[model samples]
Target: MAHELIYMDNSATSPVDEEVLKEMLPYFNEKFGNASTLYRLGVDAKKALDKARQQVADLINADVDEITFTSGGTESDNMAIKGVALSEIQKATDKNPRNHIITTTIEHPAVLETCKFLEKFGFEVTYLPVDEDGLISLDDLENAIKESTILITIMHSNNEIGTIQPTKEIGEIARKHNVLFHSDAVQSAGKIPVDVKDQNIDILSLSGHKINGPKGIGAIYIKKGVRFEVFMHGGGQEKGLRSGTENMPGIVGLGKAAELARENLETRMQHNKEIRDALIEKVTSQIKDAYVNGSLEKRLPNNVHFRFSGIEGESLILRLDNEGIDGATGSACSTHDLKGSHVLAAIGVKPALSHGSLRLSIGPENSIDDVDYIVASIKKVVDYLRELSPLWDNETDEYIGDRFEKPLEDEDIDRY
Candidate 1:
């Protein structure tokens, strides 16, 4: 008999919703027109795009004009970071060159790498460190700000460990210092409440695929009156901020997905939380020497991350795949890299423990049965891999168990 397949990698990407697909179908042929054109077909496409903008705006509690569609989260991150930096530099006087950006060490590569890229252009960057619970200190962020500090970009929720950052506090700090604040909300937008206005966020990035919409479509919310230079150049589209032919079908799909997400956010969050809590409870209780990563109480409702000693995460993932279960070790974007997760390292996870990390993010489609199956399958896979591990001796098991049961020592946490 074929093994039943269970998918628990929603943080990496989710399956497109049926309703979102239905909303996109007609745009392929019937409503196919360049939104930039002036004909009837073009006008219809333009109207669809406008409606989508409103949908995205409403979801984030932003003005309709603030939404700028992009290719994906990476593009949105790049546009927000670079756009703000360049815009500030242009407006800077001889004595006030705003060339510095502030971001956390645990940020997604899209944000981290963008900050790094700016460093090559004579821009300075401060990568604030996170604690063992994957939370950054508001004091550290404030101290990092200087006269050259132009923008502060951070992720709303961690992709690997699922720790939700205190973006509202960070936003207030930015506002007080007169700095532009941008957050990559790709992981938190649909799963949690993200009010740009309430958080005092000047800009935010979100992806469609992360919210059960089609891939290759995302948006950046730029608060009105926030000065930002254009990143792309072409026909004056997206108010000349992003210049290209709009992806009407993808936009419509994303809009519908956002709308549905808003309507069902509370119910979906509860469902995900139950499955996540159940899986975590079962796996930790049944599997010896297992411990969760990040702060349990402040994490995303769908995320459950854990680490097991004596086995590599990749090996466990392969073993679980044989049992028809799918999950991930770290960000899907960096899965090809053999190094330990930067997010884990930033949170002070030892290299050995980081190598064995596993991230299981539940979604609306995952049920209690699926959670049970995942727990069982993971337990089996970890046991099998542990047996093959050279470090899996009698003493090693006891040590691993003690490490999980006891509190972490001050020396255990690494600082950047």
Candidate 2:
């Protein structure tokens, strides 16, 4: 087994940076105060909040007042989607009852579930289809818009496959139709360039944990004058968008992380991309039947997704973990679902192939020196797994047994 643990599951969460931690330490003890109050402690906390808000806003090229703190990406997504849905419902008249929302089939569960929840309340949601490369058609977007279409909510990049969408074009289409455009930028904010004004985005969501900051803290960018109802009630914190006492330490850490991310964006992008490409090239060239899942050219700098025939993703992850290399089968949030990834399904990957998918999301801590070990370990594990797999045909190098047809029997569990 490898001695050092190599973390390649950054899309799940990244470790807090030392600088971020340093910035957060004082907030927990010395600077602890209610941001809503007027005392000295409160004033200090309020100043930190304002500074943090500006830090987050600067990362995405938005005005400071446009940023609102939230619990995390889920709350931010909910705020953008359901908040708009509820607000539109309130403004509905006899003739102009705008109740439609447009989103992609490959969006994160936060957006997907929120859209489903609104569907329960008589709201219409159009889940757009993506191409095999995980890109939506701009024409399809424009054609789907109707008089009742109120909002277009799409993710900047897929969390699982890391396929970037044409967000700028999508935003233009939304604006041309006079519909609000919102993007779940939780995965793309720190890893890529996300200019709300340049991208024509009306609302955006980002999380802290994904960007080397503290967890349970996030921020959303809502363009000035964009209408959305208050999702969280009480205290009127976050300018009445979200409520409850502010998590000062978390906010501070996030602000620091955002500042670092903005300052190091170019370096981060270049380093991650180099490492990502090396891993992809090494793995694909060395391993047979290893297919990349998304568009390599349009992919995120840190993302590398591959599917190997005749091997289960869970087994691959476990074997990789034993080799001191951590990876993921898909989104960490949906790993418990026990179903094939919706993103893979949307991109036309076969169900059996989807079961073999592995996502190795790189981070700043990972270096190119780690690539050979990762590829070698993966090749060895794949060989061992395939040798034992009844599904695999060694001579033909193909998957013979169908997973759907042959469910795990009692004997199979006993063998393990």
Candidate 3:
């Protein structure tokens, strides 16, 4: 019999919830209409769009008017960063040209790449480094802020290592400095409590697929008083902030998902945490040189990151795939990059050790039995890979094979 697939990559994306799907089906055909029109069909769509906007706002405890739907997290992030930067640039003066952004080294590529793009236009960015547990120093963030700093765009929780930042504290600092704070909550929104008012956040971004909603849908929250230029301009959709024909089906799905997530947030978090903790305990106890990444106390309920010596993360993932387990080495967004994880590097992990990492993000569907099966499969695969690795000596836990006996000469390094 074929083994049943055990999915552990929820951080990458999740299966759309059945309830969310049910809520979306009608919009594809029966209720399909442009939300900007005044006819009955369009009026219904407009109602749905408003409800979804409110649902998304409730997830972060924001006013409904503050929410604006977007294509996805990337677009929302771009809009937040660029919208604010462009607005600041337009209002720049000789004495107060706010072109500086503050972010951490462990942020998702969505935020990092956006910051890099702004650098081309003479924007100065301060990428703060994190510690071994993938957490930033508040002092470092405070020290990085200057008179010219306009925005602090940090991620709420890291997608790779699952380290949750002190967003409230960061927000307080930004508020004190009179700087706008934007958090990429794409990974943390539904799974954790994200209260924009309580956290003192000015702008926030979240995705649909991460919370068991349809892909190609997301929402951005901008506090009422926070002003950024409109990101998109068209026939005046989304209150003229984001202008385009609304994705009716996707928006409905995201709305239903948000509603369900809010209603069952505690139950979902508890279940995921149970399975996540079990997997962590069993895997570390069963496998040698298995170290957990990020801070356990401040991590997401569903994230379990581990670094196993002697085996490449790609090999581990492939081996686990054969056994019906889905896992990841780093961010799904950066899997094709081939370089060692910048996230691991930021947390002080060596490139050699960073190569042997795995990220297993649990979901409500996972159970304790799934954790046991994953632990056994990983131990078996890691043992097999370590035996074949020239860099790993099982007995001594050191590299002592013939391959390591002699140092490569200048000419010997070019063979590969």
Candidate 4:
């Protein structure tokens, strides 16, 4: 069995950074206190929470009052959607309670399933389709908006294909229509710059785990003056928006992670992009029939998703694991089932190709050599599996073997 694996699945969740952990340790014990308390201990807790909030807020270019800490990205997305949806219903004197939301088919399940839940409550959702290159048309977006449209929630970057949505354009459209705008920036926050004010986003969601922060901590950036319904109601915590005792350690760590990401954003982006692009070039050129699934230029810096045709993506992933390479196939949250990627299918990839997507999301720690070894290992495992596949019956070699009954040339074999 292989040991000492290379971790290339940053998009799923990043390993916590040591420095960020150090920053959070005090909150768990020595300096622990409820921020809601009025004593000296409470004052200490409030200071830490406020500083952390400022750190997180600075990274997104939002005011401290606009940021509300949550359990994680799911709660943030839920609050952004349900919060705005509820507010829209309560304020509208018209029949706009039967409202509509516009989003894409490739959104994360947090958004997709949340919309599904809203549909059960009379909200109509229009899932716009992406093109072959995994891009939604702006014209289609404009046509989809109606006066009853209450919110436009689109992801900043797709987790699987790394396609960067035209968020600025979409935000402008939402503003022109007087609709609330939200973006799930969990996948794009640290990898790319996100400014709530500049983007015209009324609401934004992000996860700490995606950016080397503690797991269980995240924040929702609600643009000041944008009204939202409280997700939970109790004592006035989180400015009475999300009522609960704060998670001190997790929030501290998340803030440190955000600050660190801001300090190293440019350096990390350039370095990860270099390693990611090198792997893409190596895989596409060396592995026959392997092709990237998203746009070549406008993509996430640390992602390289490829389809190795005629081979199961999960099988290759398991084989890569045996060879000491850690990666992922499809979204980590939805890996329980072996269905082919819905993201690939949304882009009109063939069933055969769609079933073969391997997403190698590089992190700041990966190198060209690590990606190179992974590429070579995938080629070996795929070739061995194809040879043993009963589904394959075409010519595979120049010389006639026990498998082939007639004369054939290896060149006649399908390279893909």
lDDT of each residue in 1-416, candidate 2, tens digit only: 35599999999999999999999998888888999999999998999999999999999999999999998999999999988888888888878788999998889999988888888888888888888889999989999999999999999999999999988999999999999999999999999999999999999999999999999999999999988898789988888888999999999999999999999999999999999999989999999889999898999999999999888999999999999999999999999877678888777776677889899999989999989999999999999899988879898887885654444333321111
Best by lDDT: 2
Top TM-score hit: 2
Q: What is the C-alpha lDDT of each candidate?
A: 0.89, 0.91, 0.89, 0.84
How many clashing residue pairs, candidate 4? 0
Q: Clashes in each model (backbone N, CA, C under 3 Å)?
A: 0, 0, 0, 0
Ten residues in a row with the worst lDDT in model 2?
407-416
Q: Please report how far candidate 4 places residue 317 from its true position, in Å.
A: 1.2
Q: After superposition, how far is residue 412 of candidate 1 from its true place, in Å?
A: 14
CA shift at 124, candidate 2, in angstroms?
Answer: 0.8
When superposed on Cα atoms, how far off is each prediction in RMSD? 3.1, 4.4, 4.0, 6.0
Error of 3 at 97 (Å): 1.7
Q: Would you list the rank order by TM-score, best first?
A: 2, 3, 1, 4
Better of 1 and 4 by TM-score: 1
- TM per prediction: 0.95, 0.96, 0.95, 0.93
Across residues 1-416, which tens digit of lDDT does each residue of candidate 4 receive?
57577998899999999999999998888989999999998899999999999999999999999999999989999999999888877766565553789988888888888988998998889888888777889999999998789999999999899999888888998999888889999998888888887888889999999999999999999988887888689987999998999999999999999999999999999998889888888888997667899998889998888877666777888988999888888789888855556677678665555667789887777776676678789889878766665534436522112252233222211110
Give the per-residue lDDT of model 1 (tens digit) for 1-416: 54787888999999999999999999999889999899999999999999999999999999999999999899999999999988889877778788889998888889888887888999888888898889999999999999889999988999999999999999999999999999999999989999999998999999999999999999999999998888799998999999999999999999999999999999999999999899889988999889999999999999999998777899988888888878999899999987677778777776677889899988888898776777878888888788777656654564343244334343333222
